[model samples]
Target: MSSSMSVNPLWLFKVFPFLRWWPMVNGTATRADLLAGLTGAIIVLPQGVAFATIAGLPPEYGLYTAMVPAIIAALFGSSWHLVSGPTTAISIVVFGALSPFAEPGSAHYITLALTLTLLTGLFQFTMGIARLGTVVNFISHTVVIGFTAGAAILIASSQIKNFFGLSLPRGATFAQTMWAFFQQFDHINLHVMSVGLVTLLTGILVKRYTPRIPYMIAAMLVGSIYALILNQSLGDAVTGIRLLGALPSHLPPLSLPELDPHALSQIAPSALAVAMLGLTEAVSIARAVAVRAEQRIDGNQEFVGQGLSNMVGSFFSAYASSGSFNRSGLNYEAGARTPLAAVFASLFLGIILLLVAPLAAYLPIASMAAILFLVAYGLIDFHHIFAIIKASKRETAVLLVTFFSTLLVELEFAIYLGVLLSLIFYLMRTSRPNVISVVPDPRASHRPLVHAPDLPYCPQVQMLRIDGSLFFGAVNHVEQRLLELEQEHPQQKIIIINGRSINFLDIAGGEALVQEAKRRRRQGGDLYLYGIKPAVMEILQRGGFLEEIGPDHVFETRDEVIRHVFSVLDRDICMGCQQRIFHECKALPSPGGKPS
Candidate 1:
């Protein structure tokens, strides 16, 4: 590492896109990339269709999203595991934002969707260029947990109509669904139910018995087979199960999004919200995999990659897209070598979809729903949820608040609430630093064990420990506590602070310490610091507080000052003290200038 730093090769951010990772490429990596890419292509098939429908777009759009955007994102993104495509979270968010603007499954709706996608991409690209990846840092872990749980609920709710073969209206809120379910109890579709049950069971069995085979595909196969058998037996017209129909075999059609000022204005805010959500999801997933892979994720580069991918995807008839957790997890499990895996997956998927798109027309909607239910179930992190609930009251509160708020409030706003709450709670906790007065363990027969700070102090010197960063947020609390210590005990004049735990000190904090030192000196007392760190001392020195605090009063060892300070103590108090805390004081003559 060099002491001086220079700007990285900025041109690499454009050309070849993979130039940043080209140095890591080798022979063993190629094999790993191939396996991961194959797994990703197989897995993305069902997910693409499911996500596109969720976004209120034609099924082809989802496949389109998985093609060009994925390859571009992989080559440009910082992480090897992050596979970009249409995801459940992004799909649901798009549906929520655009459904109110135009009727779903209409030309007007499609136009608005494309416009929104363009705007969202532009916003994300702008944020990336601005290097504002730190924006996600404000969203605490609790918020993420809570938001995911709520999203899980929404996912299950959205698929409930298909799961039970009912005719409840699409896009119903949780409360609305419950009410609608009760009202529509008589309109249950039995053919849809049979296919759904078979699909659900097949998924479960495949997972338990043949874990290597992707359960969603296995379930869809079983469901489709059952539909075919039923169609033949019932003469096709009697059954109610609807199929996806065939997809057009071609490149994602190039098209321009609506350029109207009113159209862009209408969806701009919602687009911004989608952009933030997409970036957060992508970065978070990348970071998680990076930790496990023993790799470092470049957040700024990730932003740029995601932005470019979405922008390119929008023109190719793809809707809003982001990092798919399922694809990324599968990639990691399959031993991905590099970002090339994502590029390959998209390429393979394009070829596979063309061959098998017609087979999807035989697959029932109920089967698709059953598959999505499994997807929804997998999104929830139950073990972590339980741990958070048990570990900390503040974290638990944040989780519950975020989880519930996500359902009732707007998606973007709920994240803000959780972040704000976490910050407020954090500040409240750090404001009060624990100041403890300690002594050497008297009960230890062999060596000195560091004792609790509440132990009685020496008659000659008061020893206290400051256990937190001294900053503006903590100034008043620390000052008040220190002043209270003096007021409570008038006899405790000489003060020694064990400054080992003071990790940081700011200007306001240094000034506060200086002021406190002057007040103590004026009252016929001196303040001393032990084990002063070079870093903390530098702050005091630079701020001119070291002169006021008196450099002579600082000590490296506990016994040095206490031995000399004992000579100046009152003899009556020294003789009366039963606690022989310090060996040095006990070894020396009594304070009255007489031998012990």
Candidate 2:
């Protein structure tokens, strides 16, 4: 018996896959993950506040997202390196969807946000239960690469108002935001710009020279010190710089979503949109990290985890949360070995909030914006972007389309557009399977078969290879090419199909094969298949295609098939053919019983 068949099933572990990593948790790994967690927690401090501000909620609501949702997502998700919490995209979406219905930062707005989160979670969880994990497969790698790059630009653009201390209109598009900035350039506050530049420079230096320390902490400290010195020298009234003010020092409090039918109906479309965006962001980030970590991610399990996180988070004051590229990348780069780092980061954040909530009053908004600029810059994977450009033209098209759509269109529509384009390109490639003509190379020791287009063969035989699935979509293509072969080259009636690459065969493909066999038999030859896959063979047998073509027409070995066909060829036709393509052609009996 094969070892694969002898292996016992780990059903319990599959249901709770985290058990595989739990046993490896020693003190060394714990300490490493804790350090990574500490770094991640520090970074999220400014991000949580920034994202909440984007969502038009009080900063504490963003902190609440980091607490419970981060913990729950880490524990239940399949990726060890994925960290889920408040994200800029989700926050922007929430604000856009709910701001018109209720005033920003109002009690009514918070209620609607929570209700939307609940509905989004319910939709995501239901999708996961239905085993719709393959949905993300349509979102190609190129699409993700392009989307993240576009999102990075959006992040930087969104912070331009704060970074330069411009009072632009809220919720402006990228173009409008830039136009507003240029129009208000003369009104830029020199003092606020100085603070932001100092923070940005400090972060760049630290990250370049001494990367062991968290750059955000160093940048914020330097910016805060500069603000204090400026305030002392020029007077607080003169500097005109604003602070983030103090944050709530307590943990997330229990809350409830408004369950009114009117409220649910109003937010239903937005909820569906948010659910898809959140799941896509989370799964895309997970797969990205998993690639770096050389780990496997179960997208379905991640969906269940994210769904449960948001559902539970709605009651804990979190608006909407998803996988954060900044935090997850930091977690992996900081030596985190498992999901415990995310859990620790959530817990450490709660404790850190108690001590540092007062210090937030001294942190300037310009400094926060500068740190976010750094985060946004980091998200654009330039290496992969360049590689994709140089690799395939189709992938490059997907990347460019996805990138532009993300910047120019609605966020949900951008995602859908990328996935739709990817599927269309994939179908276009698969619908026309590669049908190549091949010949045996007499000089080669291994891989003896080589493609030889326009090469001459035996007068009575034609050898070809099918290098894709034989499904309904591809049946017509294969049949049309085979029909052209018999119509154009009447002498080459015997067709041998090398089916080594055929992985799938449907009813339509089976019927096409039977039809081709019958046509060949009427021409004093027949269709033969070699190296057919078990699945295709089973389909042919079930459809009675094998009986019609005759079981003897199938060959297990290429050599046997070629030799058998050579011996049965008409001796009169063999005498005129000078090209002996197959070795068996040499052994054909001459008209007088001498070797041909």
Candidate 3:
């Protein structure tokens, strides 16, 4: 190959990320991926339909989402094992956002969902282009756990009517749902209840005993069989059992989302919420699986992949989708070798959809509800919830607040509230940096500074260490502490700050230090700093604060700062004092005006 042809442009990899891993595709890798893809395809059949029910979309739309979006996300994203499809959380959020505006599963609602997906995709794509992937870190893990648990409960509550064959209104709140169920206790349909219970119990048992089998498919089959027998022995009208109806068996057809200005404006807020939540879920899952697979994950790339998936999927009769934790985990465990596995999975899902779409007519609504109940149960991370409660009261509070907000408020607003509370808690913690007095340990060979309150301090000098960044938010608290120290020890006018722990120094912090230096100078004392980082020193210098504080006032070594401060101390006070905390104190003149 010529030099021009041999040298591939770096931008190509950005546009086509799969090229990076394409070289790993050999016979062995392809075979492994095919097997993994087959496994994933089998698992997604029931899950796709279930997630669609949660999203208030038709069953086939879930399979459509699992098809086009899965392929697109796998081809563009950074993870090799992460399978992007309809997820429990995203589905719930979609339903919650659109149910109030239009009837669930209606044409208008589907259009609204498609539009929302497009807007969310645009937002995600913009963020990826801006390289704002790190922004997801602000949504704490506790917040996600809490929000997911709350959404799970909502999912289960939404299905209560189908599970018990009650005539409850759709989109009822948790409290309202419970109240309605209680009022209709006497009219419960035992036939539907029996099918749901059988499904739920079968799922739990299969998952516990036959770990290799897909529990959802197993449970669904058992429930369907039981329902069929009941309807055969009795009659459909007599038993009052309802079926999910047949699904369309074809490729995802092209569709256009409504682009009216009013529709766009109405859906903007919910779109933003879904965008953030979806990105967080996708990136977090990718990183998690990457850890086990020993692969590197690029968050920005993952964002781009998800953005493209949803944007393209919007045109394919698919609703919003995100990373599926169960599917991704299963993909990895089934020995997926490359992103091709996800692509294959999507292809296989399409093929399976074509073959089995009519069979959905045999599936009972009660059985589907039973599967959803299991899905909701699995969404709660009980271990992490308990760990958060036991490890930190602050985290526990965040978890509880997020949990309650998700239950009490609108779903989108609940996400915002949880994020806002997390940011507030973070600011509160960082605003008050730890300012503690420290002294050198005499017994140590190098006399390293230690936080020992009981150790005697030099009567002429006070030393303090700050254990956080010096930002604008922290300046006031540090300044007040400095003033308090000065008031408490009037004789200790020469204050030395151990600045090793201060990693960042903002302009306001620099100004505060300058003002403190001037104040000390006016009082016949001085301020000194040692072990400051180079970056912080650069800030001090660029702002001219270092010049105001005097370049000589800063030192790189503790011994130099101590020696310089001691040389300028009031010798008269040292002569009368007996606290010889510093080695230089032995050189001070005695009361008779002679060298000791």
Candidate 4:
């Protein structure tokens, strides 16, 4: 049998499906993976419901998402510990896209959400197959930081409506919500506030004091009990604390994603937006965790993993899904050994959620809101933001611009703007390559470097050093500097450039270098370059510059070229020289001006 078949009969599918992860499992790995999976399953139960509600889906849909998508992504993905599920960013994006079509929580809206998921997954999968993952190179760290911080703020702002039982209008902007929340302060429901505050405190205390407890689970439990007490003390009608009621206690039922071409055409733009936004979040989080773990990321492969997860998830009662920062981090911290842990986390989460659906009827919606508030707060990297404000001016500007843009403009457009700004700044830096005029230091020196600015030149030769790449972007600046050097020192015919450090040279740059050499030669002075590295010399040779400049003119040593060039200078013209720049000039026969 072939090696491919010997490894596994499903190797053909493993190459593309990525779902072979669970089947490839063994004994020792399963032990570590189960431990990690159980830990994650314990944490995600409350978070799944909260995130689903945030996405404007029926609460059960959140648990539905945690099951299938997580399994698919983990099995197919490259990360050992990354857990894929419903996330805050994906929820906000879905709400923004669907609310325009039908009012949130309506049947029409749910259908549209599934349609959007299908389109997004299709696009991501296409991109993965086409190997276009390198496109993410445009997204800088500043853009991510700013966008995440803004998303964090949006999360906290959105939950205020539920947490305080405020009747603020739906679809209000972040700023408007803040204003409305404060304005409606007198109408706050005391019972709701008590449950929410207790839930928030419980989450904090469990995370800080117990540390190992599933704080989210504990907080929700405590909040549910507190709400039950109040309902008993004061009749449910008077206290007015709403419950999540009963959630469907069953496996995720398969459904068809809307595929009408007319429906696809109408929501095509939103699909594109969701695809970009969802893929960006997933890839970014994966890479961030991978960097800490020192693992290589194949962007195209990850695209396939996430795309398949969402595409399959849509049919299995999931809205759009991506990498969840909290769950992925917890998976890593919990000592997950392989992607099997993720698969196990998803499966066990579904089973546990189904068995415990009845208890959800007692869980107060305000408690979920409070838990999400804590989750949102954790997303902001305040220390990093402060450090950025105190450090680089450019990075700080990028951060603020991205942050404000995310809040003010459409989310997809904001990400594009931030990436565009980063590219522009990067181009600006590379466009002006350093063009420096360096002179040899005859003074006391431990190493060879031209540092003294006041040293006199040989009057017939000019030394130049280029400190950056000679790419097409730097062509205009480099050409201008070269022309200026010739114009300023017309009589200094012999030029020797120190090109030892430059490693890359394109055809344009090589042709330009040769053209400059000929320009100097036409003016009755030759061009010589000292310490030309082998790589650069190869480029010059390949580009036909060596033939034009002459092989003898290019020397490995500076002293050799200087010695040869000095002998060619007119002893009679140099005889009456006042400025004896070279030490060699002083050894020459008389009429010389200045010390050599």
Q: Rate the local accuracy (lDDT) of all candidates.
A: 0.82, 0.85, 0.92, 0.81
Q: Listing every candidate in turn, what is its Cα RMSD in Å to the true structure after a full C-alpha superposition?
A: 4.0, 4.2, 2.0, 4.2
Which scores higher on lDDT, 1 or 2? 2
If ranked by TM-score, best first, what sequence of candidates would result? 3, 2, 1, 4
Q: What would the per-residue lDDT of candidate 2 be over residues 1-596, giving only the tens digit for each residue?
A: 99976745476554666776898689999999999999999889878887787778888888899989998888777889999999877886787678779888899999999999999889887877787877767668787778768877877888887888789987677788888999999988889889999999999999999987778889989999999899889987877788888898999999999999999998888888788778888998899989999998888888888888999999999988999987999999999988999999999999999988988889888888898788778878899999989998888999999889878876656767887899999988897898776777756764367786555566788888998998899998988877776676688888899999999999888888888888788868888899998888999899898999889999988988987887788778887667777886777666456777
Candidate 2 wrong stretches, greater than 4 Å: 1-11, 14-16, 26-28, 92-104, 232-238, 260-295, 332-338, 445-447, 454-456, 483-490, 518-525, 547-552, 589-594
lDDT of 3 by residue, 324-343 (tens): 88999999999999988999
Model 1 gets an lDDT of 0.82
Give the poorly placed runs of model 1, Cα more than 4 Å off.
1-17, 26-28, 111-135, 235-237, 258-273, 440-456, 483-490, 530-587, 591-596
Best by lDDT: 3
lDDT of residue 418 for candidate 4: 83
All candidates' TM-scores?
0.87, 0.88, 0.96, 0.85
Backbone clashes (count) for model 1: 2
Ranking by lDDT: 3, 2, 1, 4
| Steric clash count of candidate 3 | 0
Which candidate would rank higher by TM-score, 1 or 2? 2
Put down candidate 1 lDDT per residue, 1-596, tens digits, no spaces.
56456535676555445886777778888888888898899999888988887778888888999999898889888897899999887887777778878887677888787788888888888887888988876667777778778777777777778767787876667778878988887787788888889999999999999999989899999999998899889956777777767777776888678999998988887888788778889999999988999988878778888888888887888888899888898899898988988988998898898798888788888888888788777778899999998999999999999888777766656666777898888788887788766666776863242646565557656777888988999999999888887877777887878888898889989999888888888988878887778899999899889988888777776666666566667667777665657775576455465655
